[model samples]
Target: MFTRHHALRAVIVTGLATGAGLLLAPTASSVPVPDRSAEHALAALVSGPPAAADLALPRDFGRRFGYRPTLTQGLLGDPSGSCSSPVPLPAEFTAACRQHDLGYDLLRYAGRSGRALPPDARRSVDTQLGAAFEDACSSREEPLSLASCLAWADIAEGFVRVNSARQDHAVPESETVRSIAPGVGLGLAAAGGVVLAVPALRRRVGGVR
Candidate 1:
């Protein structure tokens, strides 16, 4: 029977689900687009060698994004991000990770400035990251060390590629969640409806008998 208990339960479940969905949904914010020249320069830096990247650091990039590029152990520094993997990678991979972080930052900078790069831009950056990882492994001369590095490189690249596929290209991380929130909300609502309907359907069948 659809007793008072069932009715109360349904109301509570529906309310919670709807409320959560609303809270999780993304909101839009507007910011003036920075000059295209700055974005172009950042893109070039991401693609170019680490030595050349330092040249752009002192220009409009530092003033606009508050990004002060530093040099660490001869590699470009990425204080804002790093190789955040569950398992430790070879130390040589540090340079590759720093470069990859720069590419992601470019995407974030473009997004916050109201000018988003195309999806292909992200793909291109990711591809380069994988290549960099491979190159790092290739540098190992010892047979065992070479094998181990190559194996880790495969694992790292696979993880990165999969994660990248899940993200919205050139969008800030928070905005990506917002973009997908409505679909998630609708799914939750649908699930709640099914739960409530099952009890009602059972009660109706009992009455007919």
Candidate 2:
């Protein structure tokens, strides 16, 4: 009777060990992962020197709004469009911009430090804004007006740190990953979870490891 019980217990232990071991192992069956990086880009319609040039002015104006239009708009609502346009910044975006100023978003080179970024944070800012504008205009032939251009530029630039949530539906990675590390970490974490869940059963073949 005791022998019979030990055999049953061993069989159960083997099954469980095999299952958990599989969890730690790599699986041959894998899901194709989606790529999501926000390398600070925009619509391909807004590309080239001319589009870049046209987009330049509005972006400059956006930065002038204290290099914080995006941050401000993200946190507090700017109904007056005081920063870049008369068109109010969206309520949610205003809060985000505000959060950015509150040290929610850390700028690497824009300021002396992440918390105490300089007010005249222009050159680096302009470059970031410019790159965003250039991306938005890459594919389209239309030229965004100064206000519209600034609006888009603010959204794109601040997005680098403001972090947008990812959805199952695919959109421009440029827009989504503007928040930097969050997106990268989010992607990697998700991939890790899936990768570690099921390992390749045929790693050694013919038997479970």
Candidate 3:
């Protein structure tokens, strides 16, 4: 009962539908799965250092940028480390601690690898940190907090290339000093002058990691 033209049209329509689905299948499967094991390992490295007042004090600053308290609670808690004197991390800093640890671990990997970050990895860090800076700057809160902005700037300096001429030059000290100066000035008004002594501290901390 089917006319030849009608049957031909039906066959073409089904073929197109099948072809369209096949084309979309690859895109759906191409998405990378979240690497939980890698993230956990990185998180452990972050929490391994003994908790200190200096480490925990940045929580309030992190809060200003919307660090969720519930999610950060256990993540920022104290870890067992060999510290002569240990300071308990405040509940407030949990989110900040986790965020800092993750960022630090990722950048540390890039640094230790002794090669350029893959394009996707580089873009991922750049986009996240850039967006955070923009959000911090746009905050309308009075006596505006720049802690997140400064912290992000510090993290960003590690990955952002300042000197393309050298394939293996360390991140410039001046850039880091400049980025964190505002945070130190705002957070530790009286001790702001001592920030210049950070290069020595950097050597110590760099060795520890």
Best by lDDT, which number? 1
Model 3 misplaced stretches (Cα beyond 4 Å) = 21-28, 43-103, 107-185, 188-209
**What TM-score quantifies how close candidate 3 is to the native fold?**
0.27
Q: What TM-score fits each model?
A: 0.58, 0.19, 0.27
Error of 1 at 116 (Å): 0.8
Candidate 1 lDDT over residue span 1-209, tens digit each: 89999999999999999999877876453434443653564556657766776765535556756667665444465656567565567787887787777766777767666676777767777787788887876776655566556556656676666566777454535445665565455444544454445444444334221
Q: Model 3: which residue pairs collide? A: none
lDDT of 2: 0.34
Q: How far is candidate 3 from the true structure (C-alpha RMSD, Å)?
A: 16.2
lDDT of 2 by residue, 1-209 (tens): 57988999999999999999999887754532211111121211123332332232233333433442222321221223322222333233343233223221222222222223332222233344445453443343333233333344444454342332232212212343354456555444533443343233223122234
Q: lDDT-based ranking, best first?
A: 1, 3, 2
Better of 2 and 3 by lDDT: 3
**What stretches of model 2 exceed 4 Å from their correct place?**
1-85, 88-104, 107-122, 142-209
Residue 43 shift from truth in candidate 3, angstroms: 4.8
| Residue lDDT tens for model 3, 56-161 | 3333333333332122332332232111102222233334444444443343434443432333433343344344334443342322133333333343333233
